[model samples]
Target: MKRIIFFGLLFSFLGLKAQEQATISGELKKWHKVTLDFVGPEVSESDEFNPFFNYRLNVNFTHSESGKSYMVPGYFAADGDAANSSATSGQVWRVHFAPDEVGVWAYEVQFRKGKWVAVSDRDTPGVSGEFMDGAKGQFMIEASDKTGRDFRAKGRLDYVGGQYLQFQETKDYFLKQGPDAPENFLSYVDFDGTFHNDGHKDHLVKKWEAHLVDWKEGDPTWQGGKGKAIIGAMNYLAEKKLNSVSFLTMNIVGDDQNVFPYVDYDTYDRFDVSKLDQWEILFEHADRLGLFLHFKTMEMENQGLLDHGGVGAYTKLYYRELIARYSHHLALNWNMCEENGDWVKNHKTPPQFKYERLSMAGYFHDHDPYQHHIVIHNGNMFEDILGSNSMYTGLSIQTHHEDFHLVHPWVIEWRNKSVEAGKPWAIAVDEPGDAQHSLMPDKDDPSHDVARKNALWGGMMAGAWGLEWYFGYKHDHSDLTCEDYRSRDAFWDQCVIALDFFNSLPFWEMQPADQLIDNGNYVFAKPGEIYVVYFKTGEKSKLDLSAAQGELEGRWFNPRSGDYLKKTIKVKGGSSVELTGPKKDDDQDWTLLLTKK
Candidate 1:
């Protein structure tokens, strides 16, 4: 009886194994054709590019029989690793599988040694088994229409060598640094210029203008209504060592340097000038006070400039004029739009919008006489284009709770690709949303820790440019008065707390991880000898990182309390360590600073 039962159980297990071994049949997807749109200053519209260029392409696929799912191998020829890989950085040929199967799958197409190929092994040690694993359960090789009835994936092959490394030329060309540049110009720490409290606003403006604020058109009275307002804002920023400001669309009105936009062309002309005199005064002030300026360029949502031909036209034209206009002034970055491109692409047809915006980017880069660090302020995470086969600058997303976690893997992927390309990359959370909004913008809220840290830690772990926090336009201006907008003085203090934490780390000593250590729960970064691990939830949590490194020494720093405790930390070789921080309920949660001697 026992033997019969044992045989029955063995046969049952075998039956399950047989069910899991289903093979998906489908034709290998191929490239339909190549499409490229070079959007320069002269070219306002889109066109076609002749292809069949000399480059390698790889096709990747995965599927399951049980209508469940599994992760198809990621494209990994360049870096030569798959499991701890991302599809964003390399040449991604998105396989459009027909949704004939009930399960899930992911396919990545990449270029390798001038030829396109496919693989299904993502793990470095190359492990393949049943598709029951959750991480590997997202792929199903069925139907997909990336370009219409196309069963295969399509992407252009790009030179993995020095040919593509020249995008750095664009960075250098656009962001050339003058001797007078601020200390942390590239750090991107800045003030909100739209505070409603006239006094606070004036304080901030004057504080910075005392040394900064170079302009090309209109007069921004440093002593008038505008001047007073600017002064308040600058003074506040200077008090805290925060000296850069990216003005929203409100910085200009036609030709005037006021806080609002012009009602018409006449209103705009009131402040208009071929040379912005007001900006000069402000620039001179900024220079004296040592402040940096980065105009948000234009607001795509409220102004509808892309279609109107005025504001958008002015944006492109102004960048050209401003670059030459303020070439001597130290500007930190050319922030393309206030979440314009993402909004359009996601809400509209992505392919069309992406192509159109790419043209705008090209135009901006080509026109800028001074090398500027250009960035796209994406309204959502779905539009991160830094991973495209073609080269572009880094990207930033306005993360609200709506999809905070949704962006981590993507960010990690882009970082990997950027590292391979040898280009500096960054992503920041610019919109924490609002209290009334579904995403909730409370920086002090503990519930938001998972979401916020997901963005901040993700960026840090992935070797991003830096992390940024937005306090909403309404909250920023709620304290409007004759003086600068109500002072969020303490708010800035907290910001410093966060930034100071970032400054303590070896900024240049890190790079994105080629792979992630999966502990069944949390993901960590292995930068050199340190295991930078981040836990998504729980107040006090301990992790077994013995699988991370052998004979590791550790110390932990409390980011919130500025407390550094040195204790002999250990995770035996091939084992993990157990550590803890405040519980999720503790608003005063902490960050563990792990290091080795």
Candidate 2:
């Protein structure tokens, strides 16, 4: 049964003639965005390209089958040929709408024209004029048949009152395993923007050389095949079974001035439509490959770079364009800032700056019909709005040590704390620290002791949704500059093993229960049925089995090789059993699994 409740704006569409001048494109599948392109007045390069000023497209789409409706907004798509053409002006204005119901979705377009048109309501008379008003059309959306890496097959990842993110289609919980470094992940050479590492904030330049060979046939690109390198990089990650990557869409005042979507870094008002379209192609490919786009919207240095600490002109347009263009993605979150709290120059962003963040995140929550997860990366303090009443639904944390045991407590704190405050917060240890040398490449740290025992297993056993390994700054592909993911293949293998371990078990129903161990070890359990324990530094212990009524069995798991090292050891109920480490790798780290027989 489908549950329907009002969120955002809902309205009925007024039908118009069967044939309109506008063109509709994209897959007609439920949750898949349908693009509506219309002809508008052509402006010259000299004319300021301001959708916020010159024009507005307010489209209301209604599901014919269920009578459900969504008032989706559209934007200015340069020439409708942005991927192949960089024309300053052409009659191509488009609106992208993701239908929630699989049926004939009818839509009506109310295109208004005026100066500063984007600043007010649809009916507000701000230098009023009518452009493509009263335009109407309908499209059929069928059920999707995408699977494997395709998020469409898996469904939308939503924050549904749990410590984990549950897939809307499968209703299964998602466990993330991916990269969190190469902060300038979007500064690809094929992208439209200027780049200067300056050898200060970053020393390594980016060309995405290693994955060039990975670009196979059928992949997309912009003008003259300019997007292969970046798209291929995503392909490589997906092939490696990694499902996520974090990149800054804008980094003007930070490390690298190479990836902003603006026509020019200094000009935030006007976007580089061609470049953004190219990005959209890559994003679509990533979605099909089952990779989550972790869009880190802002870096620490410039949290207040937009509108001088207030949410206004530039900030509004930036977020509006981002939502209008990419909110349709099936799996993603609009992270307000990377390492968020007041990283502005001189004095910090004033106390009033809190309202700006509220406004920015609130805009996405209220405007985006999809309502994707909203989170903020760590800054100097715990997020101020981690509650049920706040707009934030999750947290992207960063730490400062090689030992990730901190991962466990922090995750427990946020998850339990937020739920107590009324909403369960999905916790992801995106960056585990000592940033100078965090999760080094496989070559730099062969054992990966701290990361595996502390960060990966610790966080998961503590009910964390998942973890993303951040490359330390000391390595060749540190946080600021990473082009080749293969350098961390060994570590990636460990992550795969960890995720595989959790997926094979009913980990979702379990919670951290460390009190059952006599020795210093980690445990996650469902009390009377299933339990998992991790032994660090070859520690031994007696697992208390009093809660379990039936005879209990145990198996020793090797974190490094993803294999079972020992057969089941049965212990009588209401008794304690001594658990040992791996038979041969006795002094090394290991994990144990227990379940009632």
Candidate 3:
């Protein structure tokens, strides 16, 4: 509170407003990020680009069309020349804005210069910086016409108090299918402050040379044609029908120190604009290719590794920069921390650490202009953090054990708990199986029978929002070092089948009902209108569809082959129906669908 007050007191001494006016830069498209440059008092990077203190500039934008308003904090761009040139000295300061509305939007700027470590408001007797204190500007935004794989066409995906994420514009519920392998997935050579020859936390080294062929004609590249391999990796995933990928934006003290936005390994505040600029290109391509970016902020060991604890000045600066630059993206979520259980050493009390994490989430939730979904990877401990008042909106879980059977009960438990707390949480099995041997390559375990039954079908059948495959330590590509996405070639087909099955049905309308199943199988139905059941045992059993009214048409779906029986089976209303086992035998997994006829 003292710190907040100190910053708030320095606003009164701000110098008289100068005649200079501010200008808006970049394209002005609805749902696009815009930069407003404030050319004022000259300040250079050598003078300390540290935004923790001294001076601060903030901006507020209001939509003229609908009267919507968004107030966001700003940062000094170190000459505002970092993107094109490395000039460390200049008079330009900038703020980024992403307008969600069309038509015209007006903005106001407030800049303060002080000798203190923190400054805000206009109360100090020593406030300075005359040129930008009262500047304002207006820009026009237009609708987007992009379609097909472009996620912008669908608009922002938000947590609308349900068990699933819904697109803001199209109102379509999303189910994610993609790779969660290679936790160090962002250690690309083309990125800033990265080394390709480095090894993962497991000490396994990979050059990612095998994925070079996957880089297509139109994929983006950086550092003057050096990003083909990394960008190509994304191309392959999109081609495989997968739509999401998880990677750490910063793991300086963890598995891979090769991926971060800093100018060096230790510095966290001065971001390398050129390197980050290249990243924006790839992310933009991912956007057009229809990919959901799951940004894992901090790994297990480094949760409290910062200068101050989790909610320190460094934390605030990092989150602010990330939100300002990338929050315009439509499909993505911020994983506050990955495996966030090892920070107990940093706090005087264990529970205090938990509150600190929650505090960070709360801070992010309140500041992020778009309010993107915020979740944290867990150590299976989410008791005090499951209520509607909490900042978390989903679950990013990690488990031990090869079969994903754990996913079913866990997701069901969290969903049930979140619902009981008045806000249903979107659950995704981020990392399943133990750290030793998680999801193996298709070449090693081509069938993937156990995984499909548990992690894929089990979680979804019990109401999960998404699933990402994790590679085990025993494989050629462990969770940290794996580069070739095609290593699990055959497993992708199974993922497609699961996602397709759900997409074909109005899954958003279906509710999980374990009572509707007579056998040990799973049941997802609208109660009376539609019934879809998963038969993991593939044994001939009776399904109690008696509560369902009217006659229904039934069919058998082959989970492995992605094929369904065309012929309809009769299911009379208010009566139990007998289901036959799959012709392939007891080892197979099959699904049954019955629609009112």
Candidate 4:
């Protein structure tokens, strides 16, 4: 509270005027990391930028020595059609600032109107350089003054009568390792066929050991019968701090209990429907690794048809038996099912199916004496199918065909709807593009490109738990087979690369926002006091960030060379920013982290 008051007092003392000073307004906290957008209603049909109401702006600010300007990272528009009564929208003017220096500063925005100009303040050439006088180092410009009074290039002056505030600059922010620490930008990897007990050639364990770790098998028996494999995988994961083992199912698929009657199981007797005492070892082993088991009560596509031999009743008895058995263990989530949609759709009309599924879900929700969180995996991405259902606790949409950049918009949509419906939301993607199915051309595969993009952007915008890559016998897509257990882990090569990409980001519990600067490429930006942009499609695109106001510091990194490219840039107000870099390569990706300096 003291800190907030101190900053507020400092700002108040910077300057004062009649409430009608030039105004610029934006949210203090950005959805993503880059640009702050102030959305206002559009009021006219005038095309400022020729056909569209576009106004170009050049933002100039005091840098270390002279002045500096750089292109903002996203899209901006003032829509005149957005007005219901007095509300109007369109690109009134664009502003961009790359402050190389910090402290109290004043800057001016030059706006060039196209076809129509309403007020003289917006119709002019250069506007007053309002003093946004007190900020730290290297952050995005977001603060604004209340008064909306400024000048135009042709000497036309307009008074906005204390409506909005002008944007300010950015500062340097650091992180700590505690709960309130800076943030845990993450690095995640999907160790599917690579490190499992089935043991394929583990490339990551040998080559990129510095950047890779073992992922816990979904269940103890999921590791296969090779006891050494379990120890080896655990040792490796613990060494790398890959400590969280989600979906730690104790029941061995195809072994313990039969999910489908078609397959026979040697360990079918191991289920011991009468007692759960046998499962303690699995939970104990996970606890020994400093790991939390994201225990899923059931896997997907396994629940038998309700009418088939009364399996539904048997399944309910099993859940009751299990929950009564293992509900006391420390788990991450009471995972309802790997694919929750099958349950809802199949069980929709039947009282037994619907009621049992709903009842089980409610048991986890209401009667879990352990107070654990309930998270269910849904098939479809739209909230109506999964989120709107009474059984769902949070939302997890597997990214099958979508690119990583779409995570932000999806999260925004989910959050807004959840708020309206009065529910707390969680956004997670356990699967992205299928690992086996390369969904792209050799160099032009949008799917492959989106796969990597999804890993990064998912964490950035959706606040995802991280993405999962499915790996098993290509033929055993549905169930595990003994033949599927190979000593060779073929996909570790890509997994190592993906993990490196994840670790390279800053992903500690970042929130989502509706604020955006759409550059029209795969690149969509969410700016806070800092800016984070995702360039998908593996293509270079141009962005008009003239409306962006702040000091900027960023670099382009060659993911292949592991080298950072330093370039000096100054964005003109409302002008398009041209991006240059490699277009396509498996490892050819770049990240730009800009803060107002």
Candidate 5:
């Protein structure tokens, strides 16, 4: 009888140990999201134990062959299936890691629980929670089978210096063009949140109804097809060949007050697990569609909402959660804040000083294992943040011109300024024009000639990485109410044409050399190898190729029609040559491409 009782106790202990083990899921392939789901302590989004602030989960993954190790932060997933089930309380805790190499990778889970443990110094391991705290395992990863427009096939998009972002595997340079407005994009009706019912501009929540037709049969949806419209919106952007999208992750007191990550509108420390899970679903689909995720963390108004504009507990936790959940994405940028430091000008919120900005960016730089591009949208004091010593990897330029005439020169100015500061920023004209009438609707301005010339081609020719169209509020399908992406369908075609032309060149190596042309046209060239001169108002101009030898061939490209004109010219290098546009409309914009023969 004693022996039988002892054996029963042993069996019970073995069963408990098996229940504590982690269940690894995902494709287990290179550049694929491999998730580690563990059965942790039972907790709720509203639990007094405060899972978000009092508990910390991090996993150290080390590749077997290369010895490359990454300490990835984990989060409290209310339920593993919360996106579909909307479960608020469960024992599930998860960490997602995208393995970059094809080999055996080992991981060790460090689960700690203490006072303010989530925001504590990561170097110190707090009190162990005892549930999967020291769990260790290994998994083998194979080459990704995904291809064509899938980010997994191209690998991570890394900012490897200079003006362009290059893929880790393909070594292809990326030039982004997409939408940058309707900052409340995440305030979808389908998301699990009370922001829609809250009295703060709840009506501004987006239904994205017009994009429902773009959602295919097999695309992801949460809570029984609740996310079709938003998912379909992403589909439409991808279908249009638009490669990036920007939206604010938090906008509590900002223009569109329907978006925030907390469980409640005013709650700052605690997060809504199910809502974030749903966001993850959308972000995962975006990865498959080859879309770059521009995570605009905060707007100007709410920049001072947390910790009174300081990097305190709430701010740290906010950035920590964001990095843990989304930094695994291959193509993304952590925009510190939109129109940051507006307090200096508007004096509404408290000023965010240079140290605070650096502190915030430094937090992301230290915590994020992937080290994705980090940038800040200007409000004022851009010069304060410039220099190689700073953490910012890029800039999101915003200009105040209705016609976007300043887009070209501003790109040049900042690009030169950043280089002069010993750090060259990957500049993009995110918000090109003024708030009143930038990029009017198809009904207001169907041709989009001004926007095409002064904004799109203007910034690109000035060596801007790309541009995101900001829909002005005065027009139909404005920024806040732009339900239909087709409102600016004609402009999208022009954007595609510009991207196709730029992608065909060795654009990464090319630098702006406007002095190469005698006229005041834009010149981007790879020295003697290739030169592209843009004539905003087409006319005959002289190009000085005096630095090169041998003959050169020239061709005229019609920017408006996306066509190569029959007009061609051949001229000897080491001399000034007169270049003329096609015999058609001489006043329209034209691009002259010259290549050494």
Candidate 6:
């Protein structure tokens, strides 16, 4: 009888161990997403137990060599293959980790259950779950085999105390240029959700049929090939050399009213698992294709929808899920809101005060192990949030001008103001033009001269990191309705030209030195190293090199054609030098690049 009892206890211990096993997947490489899927308690989206809010899955990943560690939050994944299976209930709890170093990574899982345990700050607020609560494992990561434009080769993009974000591994600064329109890019019909038939602006659901031709043979798709067009859209952007794409993740009650991560339009706490898994496929493809994700969490119209403009349980859960699921990506930012904090005077929505913004940012700061750069789009509170102590690391500028003239000065204004406030921001002109006709199609304004001179070069020369074109509502493929990115193909080429020129220089170390030029042009310089002078009117300008001590090689670049004039000049330092564009097209916009010789 004693021997039989001992064998029974040993069998029970083995069963418990099997239940606690975690399956690790993905490429075991540095900077690659290594996913850990655990078999935990089974729960449906509408379960009374509240899988999203009541359960917390936190995994501690530590690099064995450096002793570096990260406590990454995990979520209920629903059957472990929900993207394809579309299962509503399962025991698969998961965490995604992008390992930064090439070595052994040890991970320990801590699964807890209680009321609002997901957002709770107490160290031991809840009791441990049955399965995978203390599961532990280790994996070896090799050097990333990816190269070229794939972000896995570059590592995480970190805001390293400057006006630009740098890749952790490559130490390369990023300059983004992509489409900012059709903000409801995620409101697709292919995902497992009722939003398509919810009847809340259902007509805005995008098929992305126009980009289907861009999809390659090996690209990922879900629910038996339902995500081709959207995946193809990402391919198109990467092919065009545009490195960023912006979309509203949740736009309930906002413009278009078609995007949200919930199981239903109004379900705040419960998330649609399969739908988000499909989004992960697209976002993962974006990372592989070198596209930066601009996750505009909320827009002005629906900023008050969650917790009525406070960082309460609903808001906390919303952000927690977002960070848990998508924050592992290498190149992305948590844009707090689009046109944030506008309810101060309008009173149409509840006010999101400075404290609330800080609180939200504080949550991301504490929860996100990567500590990704956080930003807020302008509405009315940029001035109020400017300071070193402020949590925002950047600004998304929107200029409501018919012409692109304001793009330059607005970027300069905020860049200077942020610096004066003791916190320099990575400013980008996201919406350079007005709501009606910002960037017209090639059929209308094929030349795109004003946009090139005033917006593209204008913003960049003012030390703005980059610009994303917003298609005005009056034009074809407007912001809310753009399905085809080809509407602005020609303009994208212009953006590529600007990016290529800037990439060839040490732009991260340069600052806006407009005072060094006598003409009404723009100047960006690193003093004695290099100088980039933009002539908006293609006129010659006298650049002051009086503070330098060497000769500089000068080359005139035609911004329109993306070419060097071949005719180069040598200028002496310690004096002002007159610089001219190429004589062939001297009347058009040109950029003068001067490097120390």
Q: TM-score per candidate, in order?
A: 0.51, 0.92, 0.89, 0.47, 0.96, 0.95
RMSD (Å) per prediction: 24.9, 5.8, 6.4, 26.1, 3.0, 3.1
* Candidate 2 local lDDT, 1-597, one digit each (tens): 122222111222233322234578888887676788877666542375556556667788898878998777777777788777866566677788766668788887777777667655557545433446777668889998676668888778888867778888888888888998788887776665434443333344477888889899888877877777777789888888988888889888887767687776567777777778878888898888988888888878777788865677678777878888898888998888888764743465456555366666787787777788888877655556866568888888888876665787888778778878887788788997677888888888888887887888888888887788788777788877788888888888888899899988887788888888866688899988888888885756888878888787888888989999647677676777777775754777778787888
Better of 4 and 5 by lDDT: 5
lDDT per residue as tens, model 3, 1-597:
887455445433343333345657766777666888777777654356443346667678999968999877666665564544555556777777767788999898777776533333344424655677767767788887667878867878898887889988788999998888798887765554434443434243345677789888766665456777778888888988999988888887777677776666767666665566666677878888889999888877677766445577677767766776677788999998888875564434455444366787787788777788888887537887888789888888777776666888888788888889877788888887777766788888989888888888887898888888788888877787787888898988899888999999888778778776666788888878898888887677777777888888879898888898786687786977778664646657788888898
Model 6: per-residue Cα lDDT at residue 594: 85
Model 2 lDDT-worst window of ten? 1-10
lDDT of each: 0.37, 0.77, 0.75, 0.35, 0.87, 0.88
Query: Which residue pairs overlap in candidate 2's backbone?
Result: 53-116, 149-290
Q: Which sections of candidate 2 miss by over 4 Å? A: 1-21, 44-46, 121-129, 194-205, 342-355
Q: Rate residue 317 of model 3 by lDDT.
A: 66
User: Which residue runs of candidate 4 sit more than 4 Å off their true CA positions?
Assistant: 1-226, 238-279, 288-292, 304-317, 320-331, 343-358, 380-392, 399-416, 434-450, 454-461, 472-526, 537-548, 558-563, 566-576, 582-587
At residue 450, candidate 4 shows an lDDT of: 48
Q: What is the per-residue lDDT of model 4 for residues 1-597, given as tens digits with 9 covering 90 to 100? A: 999677666556864321212234322222111222222223232323331223223333343434543322111223311111112234332222222233433443333443322112233533322222111223333323212111010111111111111112221111100000000000001112112222222221222222222434443432233232433444454344443444324222312232211111222211222112223334445444544445555544443332231323334333433443344333245666656555456556365443244555664554343334455665524445333355445554444443445545555566557656655454444444433332222223323444445543444444443433332223222122211111212222333343454445543323443233343323324343444444543455565454456546566554334455666544433345666443345334555544445
lDDT of 5 by residue, 1-597 (tens): 999677667646665454455789999899999999998899998888889998999999999999999999999988799999988989999999999999999998888999899998855556888888877779999999999989999999888877778899999989999999777789889999888788999888889999999999999998888899999999999999999988899999888888888988889988888899999999999999988999999888888889877789999999989988898899999999999887546874333343388888888889999989888988874798889878888899888889898999888898899999998899888999999889887788988888998899889999999998898988887778888888888888899899999999999989888888876788899888899888877677888898778988889898877899786888888988887666646688888888998
Task: Rank the candidate models, highest TM-score first.
Answer: 5, 6, 2, 3, 1, 4
- Local error of candidate 3 at 170, Å? 1.2
Order the candidates by lDDT, highest first.
6, 5, 2, 3, 1, 4
lDDT of 2: 0.77
lDDT of 3 at 492: 89
Stretches off by above 4 angstroms in model 1 are: 1-229, 249-271, 287-292, 302-315, 342-355, 380-391, 402-410, 413-424, 434-462, 473-487, 511-528, 535-550, 566-568, 582-588
